[model samples]
Target: MISSNKLIAAISLAVVGGFVAEFAKPQMPEGSNPGYMTLISAAVGLCVGWRIMGPRAGRDSSIGLGMLGVVSLVFWGLAVFGTIEMLRLAMRRRFDEPVEALEMIVTIALKYGQYLAATPVYITLAVGIVISGYVTNFAYRRWG
Candidate 1:
């Protein structure tokens, strides 16, 4: 059993987490879309949450599900985008200067400070999902 307030808070945190990922994109590389990574991260969170919460529960569980869904989508999207970017960088054939590629990667990494900085937020989103589920469960059993 979950409570309405806990459910709402969970959903809100998940959505805000997704939005935060989007907002952090300007700090990413030029012509790179970080929406995918954010989506993926969110999705991962949601799936984990859903698995933990299970189905056939009350309306509060539904809220948890909703939050999980959104967050999972964001997480998956972000991961896909990140992987593609890495692949593109890896595929560069300018092998004439191996060090150049490595240097380029380092430079790119430095430029995307937001991407690095946002790791904590992404981690938090996942943690939040789990926390929300537990909180909802607690509320469902104890609050009412």
Candidate 2:
């Protein structure tokens, strides 16, 4: 079984990696097909998660790791985009269009969910998190 602390650490790394990737993604050239950032993020996610899991995982734990990766990606996306939305809303204070912070955050989060679901690059990266977990487990067992 994956220890709770290790699992949390793995998820934390993935979420932080995702945040970094999202921040840099915007500055990338339009024609650039995501470049190495995706690979780096995946590698970091895989290595850290595998390392923290401590060299062995059962079938159930392996699956759980992948699921955790997915869950963390959702969190990462929410955090990155939600921050942007919060800032955008926070800056605008139109007298006629009063907005509640809670409501705006919720609305923005929903929109971000939909946007991420439809975005191909973002989807690929999210899926990469799952693959990274599985591959990391395999690599660590065979070679490490």
Candidate 3:
């Protein structure tokens, strides 16, 4: 069922994703083309906010919900991008073994994480998620 809380959560996280993507863009290796990175991250954020954080919005403390949102966003974002990179590499026959290809997904994600950690992306995400959780909680209380 649709709810104001879910909608708010989705929108907030989507913005957070876009911000993080923009922040991370400059940190990417030189000569990398990050076409649609912001859009993809926002979409991922919308889905995760709706599916994961939305339902739990009112049930948990705002802080707890915010932390959950941040964790979910980071995990899904990394997983999606990592898998995409892995697939690109696989198509180029960069991995001789299937297992190595699968491993590359994690390796790529960790590398991405390193870049994110080195920047202000984490701070932006944390602040955004926390505010999102608060707003979602308020919506739940006001509308439900």
lDDT of 2: 0.53
The CA root-mean-square deviation of candidate 2, after full C-alpha superposition on the true structure, stands at 7.5
| Model 2 weakest lDDT span, ten residues long | 52-61
CA RMSD for every model? 8.7, 7.5, 1.2
lDDT for each residue of candidate 3 in 36-113, tens digit (9 for 90 to 100)? 889999999999889998888789998888788878998999999999999999999999999999999999999888
Candidate 3's displacement at residue 16, Å, is 0.4
Whose TM-score is higher: candidate 1's or candidate 3's? 3
In model 3, what are the clashing residue pairs, if there are any?
Answer: none
Give the runs in model 1 whose Cα sits over 4 Å from its true position: 1-13, 52-135, 139-144
For residue 115, give model 3's deviation from the true position in Å.
1.7
Score candidate 2 by TM-score against the native: 0.48
Ordered by lDDT, highest first, the candidates read 3, 2, 1
Give the candidate order by descending TM-score: 3, 2, 1
State every prediction's TM-score relative to the real structure.
0.38, 0.48, 0.94
The runs of at least 3 residues in candidate 2 whose Cα sits more than 4 Å from the true structure, single-residue gaps closed, are 1-60, 94-99, 119-130, 139-144
Model 3 has an lDDT value of: 0.88
Error of 2 at 106 (Å): 1.4
